[model samples]
Target: MKQTQLCTLVKKSEPIKGVFDFTVEAPAIAAEAEAGQFLHILCGRGVFLRRPISICDVQDKLVRFVFEVKGEGTRELSEFSVGDKIDIIGPLGHGFYVDNEKYKHPAVIGGGIGIFPLLKLSQKLYEPLVVLGFRSADRVMMEEEFRAVSAKTLVATDDGSYGYDGYAIELLGKELMESECDVIYCCGPTPLLKAVQSLAAEKNIDCQLSLEQRMGCGIGACLVCTCKTTHEGMDENMRVCKNGPVFDAREVIL
Candidate 1:
C-alpha cells in the first residue's frame, strides 16, 4: 500500500553538476520501500502534478531520491530546504525481483541517472558485478557508492573523459563473453536498454529491465506511462507506474 504524507527534507546534496540528492524523513514509505520503487513527489505549489522519482536509498526512517533539474517541477524541488515539508506518495510501482539463489552470478548495469535505483539493488544482491556509464566525466556520479556494494565495478564514458573510453555495454559484452553470469539486471536510456536486452538474449541469460517514462498519475488510472508487453499471448500496453517500472526483459516489447 502507498501513503500520502508530508515528508520533511532532512538532507540534500549535489552529487554532480546538476543532479540533486534528497534524503527525506518518511518512515511509512521507508519501511516498505524496495529497490526499483519510486516516490510521487508534489513539487511545491505551482507544479500541480507530482513528479515520479526513483527511490535511491532507504535507511531507518528516511528515504532518499536523486533527480536532475530538468524542468520547473524538479527545479522547484531542488530549492526546497531542510525541514521543509513536502507531500509525497510512495513506495510505488513494482520493483526488481532479487533471487540470488536463482541468478547465482548477476551483473547489474545502468547508464546515466538510471544508475540510482541500481544502488539499492546492488546492496541486496550479494557481490554482484556492476557496470555504469556516463556521457562524460562531468556527468558521472556515484562511483564509490556502487563500488562499496559490488564485487567488481566498471565505468565507461562516451567522450573518453574518464574510465573506459566507450559505451558501458561494450564492457558488459566483453564480460559476458569472458565469464558466466546467470542473469542481468539493468536500467537506462532506451537505446542502452535495447542493446543490453539484445546482448542478454544472445547469451541466453535471464534479464530484467527497469523502464523510465513520462507519467501523469503515479497510480494506474491515468494511462500516461504505458509500455508494450508480451504477456499472456497479447501485445497490449502495460502501465509503468502500476504493472512495473520493472519487468522481465523478454516480456517487454522495447
Candidate 2:
C-alpha cells in the first residue's frame, strides 16, 4: 500500500562527505516495503519535486534510505535533524524478485551509491555472495552490514587502494568462472551495469539490474524516468519508477 505521511526521522549519519544515511519511523511503509522500491521525499517547502531515494533497508517499524547530496533538494534533505517530521510518499516502485528455489546459486554486485539498494536484497537471498565496487578505499561503506547477511563479501576499487585492484565486476567474473553462480543481481552506474550485462551474457547467466534513473513523480504519472527496453522483440520505453528500477539484463536496452 502507498503511504503519504509525515514520518519522523529516527536516525541519521554521514558515511562520507556528502552522503547521508537516514532511518525514519514509518511502520506502514516498512511493513510493505521491499528491496529496490524507493521513497519519494519532499525535501522542504521550496523544493518542488520530490527526491526519489532507494530503500536501503527496513527494520521492525523503520525504513532506511541513503542519498548523496547531488543538488539543492538532496542538500536540504541532508540538513534534516533527528525527530524532524518528513513528508514522504513511498514504498514506491518495483523491487528485485527473491526466488531462492529457482535460483540455487546467486551472486549480487553493486557500485557507488547503487550499493545501498542491494543490502535488503542480500538479507532476502539464500547465502548470496556480495561484491561491491568503489573508486578507492575511502569510498567503500557498509562492509560489516553486508558481511552479516551474505555468505561472503568481496570488495574492489579502481585504484589499488582496496581489496581487489580492479573493477568489482571483474572480480565477480573471476568468481563466476572459478565457482558457480546461477543468478546475478547487480546495481550501479551505466558503465558498470553495461559491463555486468555483457559479462552475464557471455556466461549465459540470468542477471537482474537495478537502474538509477532521474525521476519526477516517483509513482510513474510522468515520463521523466523512462528507460529503453526490448521484450519479445518489441522495443519500448518503460517507466523505471513503475515497470522497474529492476529488470532482466537482457530485456533492458542498456
Candidate 3:
C-alpha cells in the first residue's frame, strides 16, 4: 500500500552542518513504514521532482527522516518549519529483511548519511553489532541513539578523529574476525558497498545491501532509479524505488 498525503512536520533539528532531521506526524505513513524504506518529499522551491529521503525510524504516529542539504530541493526541505504541512508519498519501496529468528548474530554497517536507514534495522535486530563511519568526530550524528539499541556500537572516522581510524567496513571486518555474524546488512557509497560485498563473499556470509540512486518518482512509474541486478545467473535492471532499495549482495551486480 502507498499514499500521497500532507504530512505535518512535528519535529525538526539539525544534527550536523547541512543535515536536517525531522519527524512528521504522518500516521498513515508511520503505520506501515519498515526499515530501509524511503519517503518521496515534495520540495516547493521550483524543484519539479520529488526528493527521496530514507526512513530513519518510526515511533508511534510519527515517521522520522534525515537528509543532507546537497542541493536546492533538500535545502528548501530543510527550511520547513515545525507546523508546516509537507507533501509526501511513502512507506515506499521494499525494506530489509526483519526476520531475526534464524540468525543468531547479525551486523549492520553504514557510512555517513547512509547510516540513517540502518537505525530501525538495528533496533529490530535486538542487538546487532553496529559500525558507522564519518569524515570526522564533529560530523558524526546520533551515536547515542544507535548505542541505545545495538549491543555494541563502533564509530570510525577517516582522519582518526574518533573511535577507529579507518572505514566502517574495516571495523566490521575486525569485528567479524571475533564475532559470529550470521548475516550482514549494509548501506553506503558505491565503493564501501563493493568492499562489503567482497568481504561477505570471502567470508561466505549472507549479506544484504541498500542501494542509493537518483530518483525521479518514488514509485515504479518512473524508470530513473534502476540498478543492475542478477538473479539465478540472469542479469537485469531493477528499480530502486520499487523492486528494492534492499537486495541480496549476491544478486546485485554492483
> Per-residue alpha-carbon lDDT of model 1 for 1-254, expressed as tens digits?
56699999999999887799999999999889999999999998889999999999999999999999999999999999999998999989999999977877989999998999999999999689999999999998999999999999999999989999999999999888887798899999999999999998998899999999999998999999999999877798999999999988988998
Superposition TM-score, candidate 2 onto the true structure: 0.98
User: Which residue segments of model 2 deviate by more than 4 Å?
Assistant: none
The backbone clash count of each candidate, in order, is 0, 0, 0
Q: How many backbone clashes does candidate 3 have?
A: 0
Candidate number with the higher lDDT (2 or 3)? 2
TM-score of each: 0.98, 0.98, 0.98
lDDT of each: 0.93, 0.92, 0.92
Displacement of residue 130 (Cα, Å) in model 2 is 0.6
- How many Å off is the CA of 39 in candidate 3? 0.3
197-236: candidate 3 lDDT, tens digit per residue: 9999999999999999999877988799999988778999
